[model samples]
Target: MASYRGAPYIAEQLQSILKELGANDEVVIVDDASPDNTIEVIRSITDPRIRLIESPQNRGYVRSFEAAVAASRGEYIFLSDQDDVWIPGRVAAMVVALESARVVASNFEMLGGGPRPWIPRLLPAWDRKPIANLLGVMIGYRAYYGCGMAFRRDMVPVFTPIPSYVHESHDLWLAICGNLSRSITHLEKSTLLRRLHDSNETPAGFRSLGRIIAARVMLARLILEARRRLKR
Candidate 1:
């Protein structure tokens, strides 16, 4: 997990994590040197399974995640967001999926103070039925949400030192790398309650014509770069 200025909810998130994790499970939290009290809050949690790594300085999400995964000892690593809530049974389900697939991702529901946001509400309706096929469609588009996915430790080397300039989305990069070695699977069940807050890297919105075009352009650039690297 990569954390920056998420002190307000880090404690709650950790509590939820501790509750869900089994005695054998291990968690590694990487603090990206938040200017806030995130580090202090994490230190207060006294669990042997939870190990905290404090970066000497601030690193962006991409680099921080790379560092965290590199330092992790778990055979299967689940990416986590500092603010989201993981529903019970998430780890068990993910473990089953990873046993046969290179990557596994689950569906998520967005929740907040009021009626569901327009984007979240429209997702299930706008997309086709039986979301299983959504995985194939994601190859040409970005589909994997970081917090909803997990992968085997053996695949870590493929993603480390993330190429400095892939205009493509982060999760897209993970899916692409996983595809090089094995197939990515999408679990039918919702494993997490993904919270939508102002601090999200990308805004939540339904797909519009402009947004579709932009996504295509970004995916194209990413594909070209991948091809170029393979050719070399």
Candidate 2:
């Protein structure tokens, strides 16, 4: 998990994580030079399994997540947002989901917010649904949210050095890479409560023409990579 000024919900998020994690599993938190008490709240947690990595400068969310995953030693990594709350049995369910595929994206509900955004409606059926066209799914309802997803450690290296052209979302890039190279499955169950408030650091919403063109180019490359992976 990567945090910046997440003092308000980081404690609650960490507590839920600690409750769900197994004895050997650990939670790694990356602080991107937050101006608030996010780091202090992380330190207050007395769990040996919780590891905190502090960034000297604000490296943004993508870099922070890549760094955190790189520092982790788990075979499978479950990404989480600092403000979300994981439901009971989330870890176990994702672990089981990871047994068949490298990446697993699931459904989630928003709380204390107006409406849930990016709720997948027109996508493939969600019964461990294997998304063959990663970019195509993204065009409609791109519900590849990190809070409701878990991926294999191998996926880290596949998309780690994220290109600036498609750097808008690490989760999107990772989902595309996983679907193209390995395997990606979507579950129907909601695993977490996504807390949306005025202070959230959501990326810019309006899509410009340049972004559309860039995405088209990126999709072509992903298609080529998918074909190459299929032969190998």
Candidate 1: residue 192 lDDT (0-100)? 77
| Tens-digit lDDT track of model 2 for 1-232 | 9999999899998998899988898999889999988999999989999999999999788888888888889998999999999888888888888898888887777765456775453233543343534545546355577778788886666666565455546677767776765577677777888897777765546788897777667766655654554455
Model 1 quality (TM-score): 0.78
The lDDT, on a scale of 0 to 1, for candidate 1 is 0.70
Q: For model 2, where is the 10-residue window of minimal lDDT?
A: 121-130
TM-score, candidate number 2: 0.86
Q: Candidate 2, overall lDDT?
A: 0.76
Question: Candidate 2 regions off by >4 Å?
Answer: 112-114, 121-132, 164-166, 215-232
